[model samples]
Target: MNITALKPFKITWAVLLCTFFSALAHAQENLYIPLETQHNALVLSVSNSHDLNIAYYGKRLNSDKEYSSVLRQYNQTGDYSQVLDAAYTSAGSRNLMEPAISVIHADGNTSLSLKYISHKVEDLDENISQASIKLEDTAYGFNVSLYYKLYKKEDVIEQWSELSHNEKGPVELTKFASGNLYFRDAQYYLTQYHGDWAHEMNPETSLLTHGIKTIDSKLGTRANLFQPSVFMVAMDQPATEDEGTVLFGAMEWSGNFKIDLELDYRDNLRLIAGMNNYASSYKLEKGEIFETPKFLHLLSHNGKGEASRKLHSWAKDYKLLDGNGERLTLLNNWEATYFDFEEKKLFELLKDTKELGVDLFLLDDGWFGNKYPRNNDDAGLGDWQANKRKLPNGVSSLVKEAGENGVKFGIWIEPEMVNPESELYHEHPEWVIKQPKRKEHYFRNQLVLDLSNPKVQDFVFNVVNDLFLENPELAYIKWDCNAVIYNAYSSHLDKQSHLYIDYVKGLYNVLERIRKKYPKVPMMLCSGGGGRVDYAALEYFTEFWPSDNTDPLERIFMQWEYSYFYPAISVANHVTEWGKQPLKFRVDVAMMGKLGFDIVVGELEQKDLQFVQHAVKTYDDIKQIVWQGDLYRLSDPKNTDFASLMYVNEEKDQAVVFNYLVNNRYGQGSKRPVKLGGLDPEKRYRIQEINLYPGTSSYIDSNQVYSGDFLMKIGFNPKVGKGKESVLLKVEAVR
Candidate 1:
């Protein structure tokens, strides 16, 4: 029973069996662990062509493991109660087909069905083939066994120098995320599920399988089930070049979604399962290994047609404005104002922002204070009142001046934290998050506002409500939080009951009240940058600050990762120079999302401003297309040499192409121009050049011959600028 030889087999099983086992493991109504070991060993066997066999060696791990069942009885509601059914719950007749855990004890061999759940996975590799075998080893300790079976025969390509591995470390098994398996063969790398439950399927069931957990977000407390998950691999067959895929859990718990890859190996390579985990006790049997090359062309790319159509559908149905009736392209004065600005400086920034075509102007933190400075997080966090010295005429005056500038005024607030020197902290020390009779160790010299209490929620909401009442012109709020709760405690909650959920609910209630009162002011979510960026937060705030790091190259991958489930319109990509560490990819990558300038641009040269102006104009032209059109990823993050392309088309005849030139450390620089597809075949597109980066332009084709399948093919260079660079091309159909 040596598990060491099983490493390669486990890798194969993880890719192929992840969807299969996850579905069945969570298929039962009780959400109970059937194994006797807290950590169980996972095994996968191909019973007979179509039927997959999955086995969990050690299911029940602890004496208190059965207590999880009691918790389920307490939490049971709606569809979750259906899992207890004796028969398998069918997915019914739909384009998506997913089968749950089919348990059979015949000859002591268990067989289950691999279920394909998400539209994203289906859309990503719709044209590619997939097969996997996943094994979870909980027998000795927690570990996973995976065996990847490549179904796609075409030239299979995978990258070796992936992002996380680039940094020097112990090669953490689950460094990218937790409760997941990370493996790399010559052709592909794999990441399995561990603790992340928000992206799991049938969350209630996933939660019951794994222990129930809580997550804090702008929406308050959400009970999420973090499950160990898996994905499938396939050779891409889209309009663009194909890359290997590692599909996993996203949004819902039961889907076969994948993060697309760009293959760079010159040699025609195919991925085979390998035993890379030697440190763990799991033993690998070389003879037990299996190899198969099958192409997954069915789930490949359908182009921008379906994606754009979906975006348009979401936009037409979703409201862009706040309940208070204010439209937003908000301008916050954090960079322009900071703590050094006076009322006069605020006016200057507001006036300039108004002229720059911004709809809402927000005064970032540092506006409120008394003797203690509001310039930093150390002072006046919960002191929500105006500083008479700094704001002599009060916020009403500032709001009036902003109104006169033709822009609605907004303010920043962090209701969850309180400075020790602040009046609120002095008045009630019990309000901070702390254990009873224990000294409260502070972060940033501040304590977290305990949202578990209704009193705290009301008090926090009242502060913002008072500010809004005093200044009716205030139309937006930039809600900010510096950190997550390090020590979880709530005075109002029971000692035995988990207080995290209560804290989340209280936070949610406060926002609900604020939205009810000042429905007109849209709150832009900002949490120490993007620590709070998730689907839960997006449900409340109209937009989110994508990250604290706004460097374009970094943002391209970040935005790409986020775009898998979130809408592009909800992500705010501001143009901030931070410290002009120049990279060629800056402007183009920043414009891919909701566009705004975060840096102090008042001092740039006329040419630079002209570049900014042109970017803004181009943004306005393609805003709808980027926000509502379907997006197709063309480059691989693993291979920096390959270019990244995001194509948005409003009409079949019109398309906008965003090209990024990534720097490759090895080999000759990318020379091949990418060939594009999914365009109007009959109409000749008069390619209008809108160059954002420096590059020589030449049309590969002159005479517009009968535009048919050929229209699906257009080429662009893989590399353009030195180091990191990107290009923007908008193709228009000319009659």
Candidate 2:
């Protein structure tokens, strides 16, 4: 991947760090990288001992006056030997004493001197500006390039680094952080999300005391619980959805990741993010290059929603593939057939697809490899071939048959793992990640593929990438990683300690290759579920299967949390067999993103099938707005009895709202007025209430015209119904 092509953000100089290099000493030479945009300005500079500090970040400023006062009067600022805290920070050899970069020079020099070298500013596509500084310590024969980007439209600054060694010798990289930021405020608090597979993103907020608060994930596949492992540092006062200053950001990395926020004694705060130094170190040969994942930081004056909007917009610009028109409707055979998959039964599933408007048929986990028949999860991974028993006519035949029936074909594959009993695992026993003299553990009866090995990376890339060139009809793929990598050592890696770092890079390489090879096919990422969904993976994959739990109420929470960082189009929300629940609620909940189904359509009653058919058509009609519109998450499902979400397009001419309530209180038929959000407010709208429940009155008039101002104020009132129920409302601005 060419680093220059990555247009993260455009920058302006709020606190310009004089870009020219003067060959000053590492400790005395202060290098500042300034990125000033209309919404905000971010200035990162190197203080003493090559410590990169976020000198200023927040409101966009016009004055170039350097805020040197933020360095403090009593502190050494950039003077390494003068400040006592410098002993525990920058240029330190001890753990918890994080340095910008730790290198071992061939000259046997004890001190790693990163003296200032040079600087450059370049413009990228989309009006993005990039300012970079080159810092090389010839004593160690190593060079490090720090890059900062500012996007013209958003209040976000992106930071990343590239590390390489000179021709003189080799260097061992024990520790590397993409960037370290400093904020002088002691009152700032840290916020992060923590959860399991189904409960993927739960917000955890706490004040920062005089200590280090780290959110680290070693699960190996971005860890469903702590993704991007992204963290936010905000003032002690809580920021509301639309108000308050909050600095939110993340590292776009997939594998083991870590972010550390330290509050030193001088009342100054520091934040660092990079490859998790979890039993990992890299050896950079002469000319070998290692690029740290991009770290995106955004400060919102209008609050968390603004930050979310900024990140969502940028993610769309970089990752989101344009929705190929209306959102697609796909059918996965997992819930429908489990492992009892056979050609005859698969045809039965596809038979209902076209009639119900599901254009894509996904053959889930059972139709791969002969040695380890995928009847269960214990085997068959890493063997990427058609299972004759499951598809006697071959998988291609099934794809052809599906195409004949008017639906495209998709398949599920776990290429990043191997079953102990599978051929790939037995043939390449050294390919699995395992620590020295330690017991090996497994998740889902599988071990993670050691992508750190160049051969392993090539093999996995060829096997899966071949699946496409070999079968041109395969329109989409659900790439899944079902194992949590516990073993921190890869036998093929020369430096056993470099497993975590090298493995992630190798994974990215494979993904990058496959994406380049098959540029048109869409891919979705799932680790168990929601485990590997982050910006890094987003660069290759189009959608994220956030959870295995398809319950409508559960998704309302899961989707809401992830939408804070990702755009709605990237979330793969499905209407599965959510047991006895109203189809109304299921489809309504599924309306927020790319929708799919997990039910046995062949078994549904005619009425239910007709409902599915109707739901599919309804989705196709309004999906353009739903997938591309700005989302306003309203009401909480965890606390309130009701949950609601609103979607409005860029033109503000169209809108859709999903309002759900479970087990009506006393059957009071209480009418709760829901004023729509994100409308033009001044324009008049013609509202249409689409009622899903057959018997109960939708309570909404068939047709009513009202001004956007009136609708947002007085709102539409729907009579609450008995049992679990949901409603959908569509509004269109009129002349």
Candidate 3:
């Protein structure tokens, strides 16, 4: 029991800073509390001298060093903190109706995880001599700002509030070298940047690119708020220039590329969204005010795109296809290529993905606008040509009719929104991103393209390299973004430089000038969906689209939190059997990763397209052991026993287990007995049963069994398969 002797009772925050500024002189008239702690959670910094800087922390979802350093599981008989405190006390008919858990702690060495509980603050203002607290459970949030500066300075917030609604606009800013911040709303954009904008060597390849970019010349005062929202508080960045100031509360993690919402008092917004780690809860409401929405991926701008399962044809011999290497699995057509797709619905979805073997054929977004006819997200975002009334033989006759159906065609672009009734913003009204006098502010109505003026990056690089010089085969290019950047300013910099780190180095110089002119077109990085899967956009787009809520019992905790820091070969996993169960639990949770198929296979029902052709042939036979193996994390996701386990080996004689029992309680014993791990003791092992949740029968074995005689005679019930059940395992030592 040495793991910090079962931690949780460590409240040693004796800062008494004059009794926390004498209880903030009875705080209320525009407050400032600022408690703090990092490493074991506890933060609360509320400052609303007016411009808002709300901060509340302490969110749990399994603590105790994440149950002894990541699910080695310790103990907690399970029941989701009494079913999430009875679903927030049955949300007492909605909105702050007096829930409970004002605070709770977990301590150490692991086990006793209701995941997270305690983070509800709502102080509107006044009463502060000073304050700061520090409790523990780790992960924290809340920081609403209007102003603070005892002098930390990132560029003295020149006009903020991206969107807290009721009209407070100034939208126009872009910067990013790390001094992060952004603003733009006509073509949709809002900012705080930090979804893999790395630069250890020009990192950002595109996951809706952002790390900072806020520019403002003057578009001031405009906030009807629609798709624009950001409150993201936590601040610190001061270091020197005297270094002796106070006012603090910081906790930064950012990886699941931005998504955090709770609001529900006629404000209706629920999406918690995250791929892995990050999202315990931060819910801020009080006098509730949020506004930031100016065209953030509501589709249109030729729609928007990103979908991938793998598209197997060896994906162009493994570079993942496009430009003659030949390793694809493609078949996209975003929701079946929306409203009208002649050419025989793209040859009946590329002839059943070339007889279930697939090769390539994407066509998301609407295919450009012609006065907008069902172009989604409101209007006709900056038309990029090619919709002479929906393909009247253009786009090179649909890439020479999808290369005569042998497949290999792609298209979808956002080019950073611009449709305030576009014609390129009516002939470049100084390329948008306003703020000289103030007035121009529109979110799903569009306007945000000032790539730091190199003539608006050569007019969006000659309308996206003239659509690859008129369809030179097209290949693949998704590249989309939705929005963020709460009124930043930029009219070619200087007014004291820093346009949110030069709009994140002008979005890595527009993806390094489109990889020096499409060095073989292959981009993907979409936002709005998967919010921008990160890792500095995987050094320039190879894959990512990890979430749009894939739902396979909720993608087993979103692919176990995107495999704790990406690399299931960059992920693209599709197989979306349109929610609410079945389709083999959405192709066994999209065959774990890197696969693809978003439906429409001759309109399913041939036994759900033969269970998606055996879940894409068991995702092409264990996709090289789930892309180069080695993961091990087994069970305990704040477990109320929706049981879970994970394995994928390669060394110690190849393993491949993946148990999950979910929804237990019938005699509370669905048959236990599971230990098994690393093999090859005295050799002799064959066993080849792939999936056995509820048992279908396919067991074989050489059976030598060593390693503590198979960890005391292997057994596995696991639970949570409420949709019947499943247990998939596969071994193969053989020495």
Candidate 4:
């Protein structure tokens, strides 16, 4: 019998049946998948022969409408030979552009191709839905799953990727991105934030021409050189606040991250964002899985203002820890006393805290260390014990005293750093991150602890665990990381390339345990000011210190840019003694976020003290509106001499406006009309000026009523003075 010939005939019949079923399934099911929010949708199409592509990502389209035509339109343009607009691009094959995922297989093969396998959509809640698409390499024993979590109400989507391999040998992953997006526009304007230690969150806007623009950080610990977020405005005109199409993306990562914006030859803008592949190439062994950080993006046709509002809503609703909890007004004694305070000074501060109506009293940096006292920043960082010489009675006594005075107590600790002179460092010299036989580098007189070690992770976790264990009433914690990782070598890690990635994972593991142990405690994420301000870290923190530079003028610019993505509830704005601006101006600026005072409140004169008390009361009254409301940027500080912004509650019943005169100009007009937004036009609102000096008259009528339509259209023109003069207005809807 000629069985070989019969075997070929059987194989042909099997192939024919498989092709017939695939065609039948394609004809019966929709090829385009739409992940929709309230008003936006990200439609993905798997109609192509071997690729998954984004068909449309903008305003919501009717589900009954077919998107195959749109996919065909996109496919008709660009280079026909290459996969121009893919949902997730890979290296090799027909893709010549920057790949989202690049890998080297066991046989040193670099060529790879990913094809769609299947997908599923599930509702997480009434406001969030997740859609996951599975793709497999055509030739390799690997699979990649892409995820998009749609925040229905906020109109924001969170995207991430997971890679798993079942290959016999290890696979070297060179480039892996959390999310990839494509936009076809004539012009693209990119707005990103970049700054140094004290001058963080400085925003810059530039036109993206023909090449690639990358924003990244190689700092292993505090990735604050350039924040991993951007706003891309697509229009024929320049970027505007409330009138153009805007795409916003922010990476939820605390360690090294990179955001690449490339304008291809066909004027298509491609954005690839995820953990940085700078010096951290990861390896995946058989049966191992690697997941990228969450990348959040939103599409808005109403302009940057709407984009900012949606992101802020999403952050407060889901991303922030204890998103709806109260952020108490605090008085931190860092700038007031520095590392030179004793127990008596703290007692005095506690008295002032009660007198000034502050909710929490935070003792910053000088209270710890036993064998090596933390008298300064250069010593006793790793030792978490209270300094016996300074405290004499221990931190528990202080916590008790503060509680007796009707004020909560908090303390600061930089757990991820160690001083060479400390007992902990001397005992375990291998815990510090350093290359073998290399001279260790120091920043701010400290070295970063090698968190890649499990023992070190346990120690870091204990730094917080022991504090609450000793003083169960500890109301808050300020976790600070003072230095960036340098000489990035981990003694516990086998491969040097895994140092950065593993360090972040270890940090997160410790944080996760701490959060689980102390879930209700309010903790602030601080790193030499605004160094570690990212979404991933904020998930474990209640708030963040925006910057060490608390000068009101500098904070005006800093907080403005920060409000574009982060909510006001997460901003810890402090009124410090760093600027010559008036006390009222300083307090008003701080009141725009989470209000705090870092100055010597006991030294305030009678008049200033009264004003401080008045401002605190005013902030207490409107804090709910400020923290939980929708923010609208009325004026940009970059274009004008004054900055104005407002927050309106969800009910549209109450609102608060903050106006600051940044710089004075010669012969400038004394009064300017500021247009308001985010209001019900039919309702009548009663406006009153608060936080004014005793017996001082406002620029307008203190208590007046106006229709929302008039307020939005005609606006209110307030009488202004020189620079540093500010105004705070409270508006209430008339019942």
Q: Please report the candidate that would top TM-score against the real structure.
A: 4
Model 3 misplaced stretches (Cα beyond 4 Å):
1-330, 333-345, 348-382, 387-390, 393-411, 417-426, 432-448, 451-489, 492-498, 501-531, 534-561, 565-571, 574-590, 593-612, 616-688, 691-735
Error of 4 at 318 (Å): 0.6
* TM-score for each candidate, following the candidate numbering: 0.60, 0.88, 0.31, 0.94
Error of 4 at 707 (Å): 0.6
| Model 1 TM | 0.60
lDDT of 3 by residue, 1-735 (tens): 575753433322333333344334322332333322211111222222121112222222244332112111212222111221111111112224222112111121111111222233332233111121211122212112221111111111111111111112221111101111111111212122222211111101111222222211111111101211122221122111112111111111112122333323222122221111111122223233321111111101110000011111112222232312222456677766665565556667777776556557777776676765426655566777766666667677767766886777776777766766656766777666766677776654665776666777766667678888887778877776655443555677554234433344456577668777775566776654554443334346766665556656656665654453344555666776565665665666565656677578887767666656665666667666666554444453334344344344546566665655444456332345555543445544454546433324433333534443453256333333444444455666665
lDDT (10s digit) by residue, model 2, range 480-532? 88788776777886777777777788998998888788876788888767888
Write one digit per residue (lDDT tens) for candidate 4, span 513-599. Answer: 998988879999998888887888999998998888889989999999888888999999998888988888889999988999998
Query: Candidates 3 and 4: which is better by TM-score?
Result: 4
Every candidate's lDDT: 0.47, 0.73, 0.42, 0.85
Residue 195, model 4: Cα distance from true site in angstroms: 0.4
* Cα lDDT, model 4, residue 295: 89
Candidate 4 accuracy as lDDT = 0.85
Can you write out model 1's per-residue Cα lDDT over 1-735, one digit (the tens) per residue?
879889989987675455444443343322222211112212222222212222221122355344333222222222221222211111221102122111122122233222211111111243232222232211112122222212122212111111111111111221111111111122332222222221222111121111112221221212121221212332222122333232222221111112212221221111211111111111112222221111111112232223333332332233233311223565566666567778877777787676567676777888887866587778888888777777888889988998788878888888888888888888887787776767767755767888878889989898888987787767777787764454556667654133444565577688778877776557777765554543334446777765667766566665765554356677777766653434224666766777766555577666666666566667777777676665666655545564555554657666666766455345434466555555656766644445453334533232333342454565544344544345566666666
